[model samples]
Target: MRLWQRTMIRLARSRTITDFMHASRLMRPFSSRFVGGGDAGQAVATAQELAGEGIAASLFYLGEYVDSEKLVRENVDALLKAIPAMAAAGLPLHVSVDPTQIGSVLSWSLCRENAFRLARAVAEVARGGSHPARPALMLDMEDAGVNRETLQLYFTLRENDLPAAVTIQSYLHRSLDDLRDLAAEGAFVRLVKGAFAESPAIAHTVRSARNASFKAAVDVLFSQRARERGVYPALGTHDHRMIDYAGMVAQANGWRRQDWEIEMLYGVRPGYQRRLVQQGFRVRLYLPFGRSWWPYSIRRVGETPRNLAFVLRSMAGAAG
Candidate 1:
């Protein structure tokens, strides 16, 4: 990673900094840009609006590395409620959850149980929606430290024949193998150019390297073998070049517009998202909502450190 990105990643992990940012309203404007809103209702409304323009949305309740079981249960219950509500609005009921926030830290068994529970709910909703795409309990791939457990949980979900998806971060050296393995299982995957900062020994340390890995990973995701297994890959990126590359690969594999999907943050690269949709590509907006937006927003800025300057300028403008 570049020095700035590394610094930003470290800053994102600082509890002291997180507390300060959450305590003040200075970050609210910045958070609002990325987060859909403070509740499921707002997220559903945003999805409803996007649906009018031929786009889909994923509802992500935001919390991670939660300290208490009470908070974990709250997150679980909130997601359970959000699923049907989104489906009821005629929107695709996709939800992303972080294992750490959902009892992984408290008890692996508890986490697994909750995940299976949510996946069952998703399966039921998906059967009723009749949307071409399946309703998925998307498991967000968090920091490398938590990845092993997250991935295991996803496999567990799939083993149960539940509706679910898993995210793969391309920066990690092991992702290509993981992608290949998941492909055989007919996994639904969202591929992300990873955002966490880690040592060069285990992760690509530069953007160019990360993008290179991302490209390689996409090949595995779009290969004929993956296609034969009913694997569906979602390219989660704002980089037009990468998106184009994926389109080319999908075409080479004889895949259609709806065979795979593209995911972008709700407010990031709006025009690019629409252009893809116009060209007959499936798109899903990653819409996060909750009272606690600090971690998610910080990760966004950390993913691209230059965003920090934009946030600072916005805060300054608000002050003036």
Candidate 2:
């Protein structure tokens, strides 16, 4: 890591800093941008508000890397609980799951099994299209380490004919080939310029490289056969330039406005998100909730260190 990046991570990891933000109501104004709350009710309610505003949502419970089967079961139960309320509200909601949150510490077989079980449940709900209220489930991508198992489980569902989506980060070098292969077979791709910290051997560190790689991957996703696999690309970013580029790609390819969606983190760039929605583009807000917000919020700040200054300013009542 560069000297500045390393320093930023250290600042983000400081217990004093994290604890204060977690304990203070002063931070709520900023936290409200990204995290719904630490509970299902708050998250669902927030999602409904967004739906009312013509924004779609992907509800993510904020927790990961659970070591016990019991905790894993609880996570599954949480998602199961979320389904009915989201359904009843007629909200545009998608269920996002991280397998590590369920059973990463368990045996590998058990971990895969837990993911499969979750996928099956989501499949069951989605296949209930007759109900007209079921939400789509997306298997979130973890660090490069979990990519293989993630793909295996995703393909298993494909074989079983379970309809689902997978997120792929652009930072990893191998994703170029991965995108081509997956796009060939058909998959819904959520393209994010990744947020995790990783060693240089596995991930590109320079913003330029990451941007180039991400754009290349986007090109692959928009290939001729994309729409056949329901490959409506979800551009998971807040950068205006990248959003403009996606618009050009859509126009060049003659893609319907519905064929692509812009996704933004709940608390970042609200004005930009609103403007895009007003322009008739589908917008999906990543609504993350739960007590696990601390770690997730830290990662977000670490991803863009300038955001740390913004958070501190928010704590000081300086920014909205």
Candidate 3:
């Protein structure tokens, strides 16, 4: 990572600063840019609104690696509660949960239980035909340290015939192999440039290198036989060049629009997202909400230096 990105990542990781930003209204304008709301209600409402606009929604309850079983239960309950509204609104449910946030901080058994509990809930909602078109549970990949656990949970759920997906961070040296493994299991994969800061040994320290890794990962995602398992590779970057490249690569391979999906954050580049949808591409907007928005907002800024500067300026403007 560049020195500035490293600094931003450190700042974003600080709980003290995150708390301060959340407590003050001065950051609302900035936060509002990336976060749908500060609660579940607003998130669903936003998703409903997006549905009206012909865009798909993916709900992510804002939280991080959780240590307590009680907290994990609460998170699962909250997700279940969000489902009714999502279903009622006629929105296809795309449930995303962080295993670390659920039980990573606890023992391995606890983590497995927590993940299984989440899978059960997803299966329940999925049973009612509430979202027949495409209903899935996404296992949000965190730092590379938890790669083994994430892959294990994915395999465990897959073995049980659960409707599941796994996110792979291209920046990690091990992700290519992970992608190949998940492909054989017919798992939906979200290819992200990765958000966490890592050492050069395991991840690229430069933006260009990371982007290159992401492009290569996409090649792997689409190279699989779509006729057999149907690859649902979600490109999670806002870079127009990468987006254009995705279109070209898909076309060259004779893949249709539904073969892959474009995933973007809730509030980033709405116009561009719309244009993609307008062009007949499947676009899923990741609508994140809840009282845990602070950390998420910080991570958004930390992902790109330009986003951080824009947020800082917006916060200052809001204060003024």
Candidate 4:
């Protein structure tokens, strides 16, 4: 990782910095650009708006690394409420949850139970036919420390026939193998260029290598074997090169736009997302909400310092 990205990641982890940013009036506008609102209602509204514009959404209530069972249950209950609300709004939404937020830090057993509870709630909502299609319950991948546990929880969800999707980060050396394994199980997956700062020992530290790895991973997802196994791939990226590469692969394989989906963050590259949607591609917006927006926003900025320009522009507009 670049020095600034490493520094930003460290800053994102500091409680004092997070607290200060959250408390600052100036951070509100900046935060609004990324987070939908501080509650589920706003998230659902955002999904509704996107639906009107021919886009789907993935809603995430962002808080993580829960240490208490009470907190974990609260998160699951929040999702349980959000699922029905989205269904009521008639939005086909993907609900994302961090395994740690559910219970990874407490114990694997606890995480599995909480994850199953959330997954079951989502499945029940889908059965009612309130959504356009069966909504997906996606497991967001965190740092390397919890990667194994996260994958295990995802597998368990799939074993029980839950509509679960897992994220694979291209920066990780092991992701290609993991993608193949998941494909064999007919798992749905979202592929991302990783965000967390990791040691060179475990992850690709070179940008060129990471990009190459990302392309290679995409190739595996689009391959005939993956298709035969019924693996659904969602490409989560804003890079034009990667997006074009995905389009090329789809065309060459005679895959229709609906065969796979393109996923992008809510705030980043809005115009690009719209263009893809206009071209008849399936697009899903990753919309994160809740009071835990501070850490999440900081981490996003840490991943790409260019995002700081958005904050600056928001601040300037407020000042003017």
> Which one is best on TM-score?
4
Backbone atom clashes (below 3 Å) for every candidate: 1, 2, 5, 0
Model 2 global lDDT (CA atoms, 0 to 1): 0.75
Better of 1 and 3 by TM-score: 1
Using alpha carbons, what is the TM-score of model 4? 0.96
Q: Per-residue CA lDDT of candidate 4, range 1-320, in tens?
A: 46777787777667799889888887789889988878999889888898999999988887787788888887888788888899899888479999888888888888888888888888888888856744789999999998888898888888899888999998998999999898887778999999887888888979898899999998888887777787888999999899899888767766677778999998998998999989898999899988877778877888888898988988788777
Against the hidden reference, what TM-scores do the models get? 0.95, 0.88, 0.93, 0.96
Model 3, range 1-320, lDDT digits (tens) per residue?
35655676566667798788778888778777877766667888898888777788888887776766787777877777777667776778787888877777787677778677767776777787647456778888888788888888888888898777889998999888888787665678888888777888998868788888888887777763642566678888888888888777777777778877889998888999898888888889888877767777767767766677777798789878
Q: In model 1, what lDDT does residue 174 have?
A: 90
Q: Candidate 3 regions off by >4 Å?
A: 130-132, 224-227
Q: Which of 2 and 3 is the better model by lDDT?
A: 3
What is the TM-score (0 to 1) of candidate 3? 0.93
> Candidate order by lDDT, highest to lowest?
1, 4, 3, 2
Q: Candidate 2 — which residues are off by over 4 angstroms?
A: 1-30, 127-134, 317-320
**What are the candidates' C-alpha RMSDs?**
1.6, 3.0, 1.9, 1.4
Estimate, for each residue in 256-289, the C-alpha lDDT of model 2 and write its tens digit: 7787888888888788889999999999988888
Judged by lDDT, which candidate is best?
A: 1
Error of 2 at 9 (Å): 5.8
